[model samples]
Target chain A: MCLKPQHYEDILRDQPDIGWFEVHAENYLGAGGAPLHYLETIRERYPLSIHGVGLSIGSADGLDTNHLERVAKLVERFEPESFSEHLAWSTHDNHFYSDLLPVPYNQHTEDLVCNHIDQVQTRLRRPMLLENPANYLELNDTVTSESNFINNVVQRTGCGLLLDVNNVYVSARNCHYNALDYMKSLPLQSVGEIHLAGHAVDDSIPDEALLIDAHDRAVSTAVWKLYDQLIQLTGARPTLIEWDTNIPAWQVLLNEMVKADLLLNQPPARLAHATEN
Target chain B: MPQKTDFHSRFAQALQDPQINTRPLLKPTGTANQRRRFDVYRNNRAVSLIDNLRSAYPAIFRLVGEDFFNAAARNYIDRHPPTGPVMAEYGGEFGDYMAAMPNTDSVPYLADIASLEWQRLQSYHSANSPVLNINELAKIDSAELVNLRLQRHPAFSAIQSRWPIGSIWTICTSDAESATSPAEVDMQRSESVVVTRPGLEVLTNVIPATGYLFLNALVQGKTIGDAAEPALTEDPTFDTGSHLAGLVALGVFSDINFTTE
Candidate 1:
């Protein structure tokens, strides 16, 4: 479950039966306030996973040392079970765009992303899980497939994957690729956690559909099917129900969590097993 | 092949500038299709930042109404994109930005209202500290008490505005059912506010001119006696003793330190 400020009182009062909670690292970066105060209180009970939305890990300008230091301090204070960032960039020169922009997946970008990941890992003294971005359009400079790009990053940097299934579904539909094939091509063995969220469709172009990773509603039926299929392959990972926008009531989010929890507990239809002669 | 930075520079420029065609950046496609694809990012960048500003300055948003606030926000967005990832610290210049916009003179108090809201936000997020109690001053010697310097709480801030900012802010932020009408506001009156969040909830107190002067002097590292001089000069009947006690109750001062020499 993702912790939102609106749900703070509910969580504190009910002490709901949740596995753990995830929080956007940037929200708690302030000096002191009700946010930090409640986070500390909640963390005392539930395990925390810090997911950063603004790290801009793929920025070509290298990492922002000042922002990196602040994130490092936050991680130390919380000591979350895992820390994750996106494979997209949100900054150029010195201006932060506040939206995850895609990076061309070629040799130059591969090297740049790997170097930035290495710096982040070294500073934090921990391995970070890199998430696959939800792409709306492909850049002209692309020379490799998205899976290959992610595989190469994992191979070179040894960072785990935060496999967002909704992104896979959204990007696959938008970029004209098979979601199953794309998911299978990646380094599934490195997946440390999973993310499931909602998306909105933009059907403006004639005879075309583009799905935006809006995260503003309930997980779509197709996304749920994909999640179930993924659990069969990956064999039950820590899953999060991400409802960032148009956040519903506490009961609504908890219901979504319960749905994922039910799927997580079910036996995988076909386990990954190697045959021996 | 364009280098990583080159691609980023061009892409970033296009996101901000509407006239620049993204066809040059995207994979070759129909002109309309290229624009439709690129509009997603452009819209996300603008809407997300605007939402951040709206959350930070709800009073400003309500004062100007949605259409006007969004226009001002869009103009401000182009000129002042956030320099970092911390959204809470992103709109530090929006008040000044709104003040500089041309047609904002229609609501001259908009900028000062923004400052009051910004101060409240700063008070809510600033570091927490142990507040100084009035009883703490009893330990000090009477002769040395006047020479004592008081440290302002990390979450304490004072704003002096020409418009009745405090009243306007209260009406804008309060529930609509009980909110005072805008016509009831006295535009000629000068208002000041002292924001403090000694606990979880932030409190905004309407203050007088002498209070602002005394607090400003303390903020500049002036001793109690020196700070009182200005307040006394402003109003002959200024009572430092009771005024200091009131501020202490409000948790304005965090600590009292005396010059070691």
Candidate 2:
């Protein structure tokens, strides 16, 4: 569950049975404040993971050095168990777009992403995970497939992957591809973590259904299926159920985590049988 | 066959301006409709940015109501997009932008209220520091008291406004009893407020003009005696010892340095 100040006392009071906590790296970049204060207190009890949304790792213009330094500082301070960022870019020409944007999967894009990841790992002195993006539009001139692009980056940089099953489902449904095929094709062995979140269906289009990664509602049934499929293949990795928008009550979010834990704890034989059919 | 840069540039242009046609940039994929897919991204960009502004300026949102605030925020975002990824620091310029907006002419005090909210935000996020105490002053030599320089806390800010912004902010943000109408506010009364976070909780105190001048002078590295000059000149009845005691009690100073001169 995403940490908020209003829920801090409750979290400390109840101390829910959670595996770990994840925070957006950008939110804690301030010099000092309540956000840092609470995070420091919470870190003493629970293992922390730093998930970066503003790194813009996929920008063709190259990574922002200042932003990388800020992330490095945060990593140094928190020393989180895991650090991850998205494959999509949100910044260009020094302007932040406030959303993860799609990039054409091609050799040029692969080289840019690899070089950016190398810089981050070098500065941070730690390996980071790259998340699969929930894409809306597919570039017509795209030369490489999404799976091949991610696999190539992992092979070259030796970085781990954050398999966001919800993103896969959203991108697949919107782009008209088989979500299972996409999940099955990814380099699951290199996946160090799993992300489950909710998405909203865009009803703007009359004929087609477009699922936007809104992270507002409960995790969709289809995403949970994809997540179960992924866990069957990769086994239980560190899983985080993200709820950024329309954040539900702490108990409701905890219930989602409980659901993920049940799936993660499933026996291998049972998961194998489930995966078969 | 556009290059990656050309494609991104065109895509960003389309995101900023819905009127721009991005169909030429796409590769002409067979089945799926590109326009509908691209519009989702456009809508997401606008919605997310507007929501961020609303979160940062809740009091402003409440004051202007949702429809007007959303309209102004949409216009402000299109003109001044965020230069960095820090959403908390994104709308610092919103107050100035609102002041110049044509629709805000009747509500001139709106800008000052926005400024007060921004100061509160800055104070909330500023660096933590150990506040100065009376014991720290006692440790200093009495002979050097006149030449001592005091540093304001990192989370300290002073806002002077023509309108009673402190009361206005309190009324807008709190659930306590307040005047039923905006006309109840006395616009002729000028007010100064000092915001400081001695601990984790941010406190805003409406101070007299003398207090504002004294603190402002001290923040500018003026000595205690020098800082008191303006305050006393403005208000001949101002008591330096009492004012100093009150400010110190408020945890305004973070450090005290003795001057060699």
Candidate 3:
């Protein structure tokens, strides 16, 4: 579950049986505040994962050393079990975009992403997972596919992949691709974590159904099916139910976690056939 | 192969300005409606930044109402895109931005109110440090008290404004039914406020002008004698002992450096 300040007390009071807690790294970058105070308290009880949404890893110019150092310090302070960022870039020429942006798949971009990931890993002195972005536009055509690009980055940087299943479903629907085929093409062995979130359909484009990754509601039935398929294939990596916008009641969010845990604890033999094809 | 930098530069330009046509940058495989799909990023970028502003300045949002604040926030965001990822640090310039916006002459105190909110946020996030105990000063030699340079706590800040901003902020944030309207506020009355986070909670206290001068001077590295001189000059009856005690109780001073001649 994504930790919010309002839910901190409830989390401590109930102590839900979650696998781990994930926090946006940018939120805790303050020098000192209640955010850090509460996070420290929560970290003592629950295993924490630092998920970065603003690293702009895909920027061609490269990683922001300042942000990278801030995140590195946070990692040093918390020593979270895992750290992850996105394949998307949110910054350009010193300006930060508040949204995760799509990057073109090509040899040049692939090399750029690999070099950036290498820097992050080197700076943090540990492996980090790169999440596939929710793409809004397919920018360029070249030698590398999205899956191949991610696989190449993992191969070159010795980093892991954070498979955000909602992103896959959103991208597949928005960009006109088969969600199952896209998931199948990913290097599941490299997936260290998985994310399940809600998305909304953008009514602006009436002709074509464009699913925006809004993260507002419960996980959709179709995305849950895709997640189930992925977990069955990958043998249940650590999963997170992310609800950033329109956050539900704590019990409701816990219900989603219960659902994820149920699928995660499924019998191995029953899901073994998923890897056959 | 197109240079990655070239493609990213164009993409960034398009993300900021919807007028920029980036259809040439895309692959031919996707549907012909790539432009409409691409506009999604632009919309998300604006909406998310506006949301950040709204979160940071809820009092301003409540004061101006949602539609006006959103319109102003969108304009400010386009002009001043955030340079970093931290949303808390995103809208520091928004108060000044709002002040310069059109049709805001009617609510001139809006900027000062926004400034007060900004200070509250800064105090909430500033570094936490141990405050100097009252007994610490007792240990210092009486003769050395004049030259003692007391450092303000990291999370402490004093704001002085011509309009009654502190009361305006209180009215806007508290129970609205009994609150006085901003228009009824005395435009000529000046207000000063001290913001500090002694513990986990951030407290904003309205103070006299004398207190503001003393605290402002002390924050600027003035010695005890030098800092107290202004408040004394402003009011002959100013009781430095009581004021010092009150400020200490508020956990304003974090350290006292005794300089020996």
As for model 3, its CA RMSD to the true structure in angstroms is: 2.6
- Model 3 residue runs over 4 Å out of place are A204-207, A272-277, B1-5, B29-32, B135-147, B175-184
For residues A148-243, write the lDDT of model 1, one tens digit per residue: 999999999999999999999999988788998899898988999999999998887767887899999999999999998787778879999999
The sequence of per-residue lDDT tens digits that candidate 2 reaches over residues A25-69 is: 988888787889999999999999999999999896888899899
Model 1 interface root-mean-square deviation: 0.9
Q: List the residue pairs that clash in candidate 1.
A: none
Put down candidate 1 lDDT per residue, B158-252, tens digits, no spaces.
88988899998999888878678989988899988889987878899888889889888877888888899999999989998888888888889
In model 2 chain A, where is the ten-residue run with the lowest total lDDT? A268-277
lDDT, candidate 3, at B178: 71
Residue B134, candidate 2: Cα error in Å is 3.5
| iRMS per model in Å | 0.9, 1.4, 1.3
A35-108, model 3: which lDDT tens digit per residue? 99989999999899999999999887778999999999999999999999999888988999888887878888
> Which is the better candidate, 1 or 3, if ranked by TM-score?
1
Of 2 and 3, the candidate ahead on DockQ is 3
lDDT pick, better of 2 and 3 = 3
lDDT of 2 by residue, B42-115 (tens): 88888989998887777788788899998898889888999999887889999889888887777778888888
Name the regions of candidate 2 deviating beyond 4 angstroms. Answer: A271-277, B1-5, B30-33, B138-147, B176-181, B259-261
- Candidate 3 collision pairs: none
